[model samples]
Target: MPLTFEDLLARARALPRLGHRALLGIAGSPGAGKSTLAEQLVRTLNGEGEPWVAHVPMDGFHLADVELDRLGRRDRKGAPDTFDAAGYAALLRRLREERDEGGEVVYAPGFERVLEQPLAGAIAVPPTARLVVTEGNYLLLDTGAWSRVRAQLDEVWFCAPDEDERVRRLVARHEEFGKSHQEAVAWVLRSDERNARLVAATRERADLVVRDLVGWPDRHGRPRTGGEPGPVGTDTGC
Candidate 1:
């Protein structure tokens, strides 16, 4: 029998049992369904009863366009250097070490899709949250400040779907987010592909490699604006 989404849910549900609070990291190349899987896990696991799971995306650490301009890295916005890796690592550390002493809330930054900027204190993790699901492209990366990220997570899972499907999803994602089809395709091949290759090299470092998640929506399904397209594909190439 194959491992279904229910099996994945069971794994996620058991995470908090390992400690006071557990952070689950989902890493993947562009359009590999990292965000979508994380979202579903949080939703289904919390649906059982009172919500104890939280979703905190690493996209919030993206450097604003202005900073990218100053740094002359605007061309490679999705590259690892275009983000505040150190800041993200620190936030993960805080999330792991800090407990709700007396109804304390740990706020996290969020990414504004339309504006393509990071919004501070956009997400609130209340005292009730025991599991935090964070998805990003570089969680397993061992370079620079990114090296600190994996240490903060209880376990990290890498999403590896088919290459062609991943590229198609990346194209569609850019189009839905305001880019012209041609521009989206060009960006995917030029920029996103480069970043994707870097992320793929880090796959072996993950605790689990999720190939295909059974029952996930197909790519042709109604698309999400700021998140990954539905999981569609058979080949497991990250």
Candidate 2:
């Protein structure tokens, strides 16, 4: 009765409908491994060939610092209201439409952790891409425009790991991103935890609750020097 990693992969591999694009959303609390799983799914599915699966993370929608400062919500950067939810939904819709119409390449934005800014058109969804894999902390959120995100997605899976492990990963991630241990620990408790609780509240709204983490080893076994989180399907970068 469990959805193994392989099962998830199989389901993702089969998501595209006849001549239409498929949008798969991964939702989870902070450090729940959503990004990791999405990346792994796309990577494994694409194998060594051309990429048919494209990764479009919701982090790109995070409000720029200037905007957040203007809104006076900079302290709560990861909160639901801190992102351009409506814009994100619009992109999802466009990605699907472009894929379905077999039109020009679809360009998506990317988030830069070091600068804590969103780079426009940083990610490209090729015309050949049939599946769009997206992950974020608020995919299942029902607030404001967030509710519309679910409509654009074919399926949304919730990633949930042990709370303690999630916290550990979150702290480590912050440290890897240049925050001192104390600062990382403090930020995790003060900020990330709040976001995590909000995200956890939406778990029931997801199509699947993924609890297992593939591994906890130094993800990608790479030295933890980068602030950006990548396919940690193998870090909380999820």
Best by lDDT: 1
Q: After superposition, how far is residue 66 of candidate 2 from its true place, in Å?
A: 1.2
Q: Estimate each model's TM-score.
A: 0.90, 0.88
Q: Which ten residues in a row have the lowest lDDT in candidate 1?
A: 229-238
lDDT per prediction?
A: 0.84, 0.81
Q: Which regions in candidate 1 have their CA more than 4 angstroms from the true location?
A: 100-103, 217-238
What does the lDDT read for residue 16 in candidate 1? 84
Predict model 2's lDDT versus the native: 0.81
Looking at candidate 2, the ten consecutive residues that score lowest on lDDT are 229-238
Clash pairs, model 1 backbone: none
Off by over 4 Å in 2: 100-102, 215-238
All candidates: CA RMSD (Å): 4.0, 5.0
Tens digits of per-residue lDDT for model 2, 116-214: 899999998888889999999998889799999998999888877767877888898899889999999988888999888888888888876777454
Per-residue alpha-carbon lDDT of model 1 for 1-238, expressed as tens digits? 4555666778788888534889999999998888888887887778799999999999999999999999999999999999999999999988887664554789999999888899999999987789999999999999999999999999988888768778888898899999999999999989999999999999888877787444554333343442334333323222
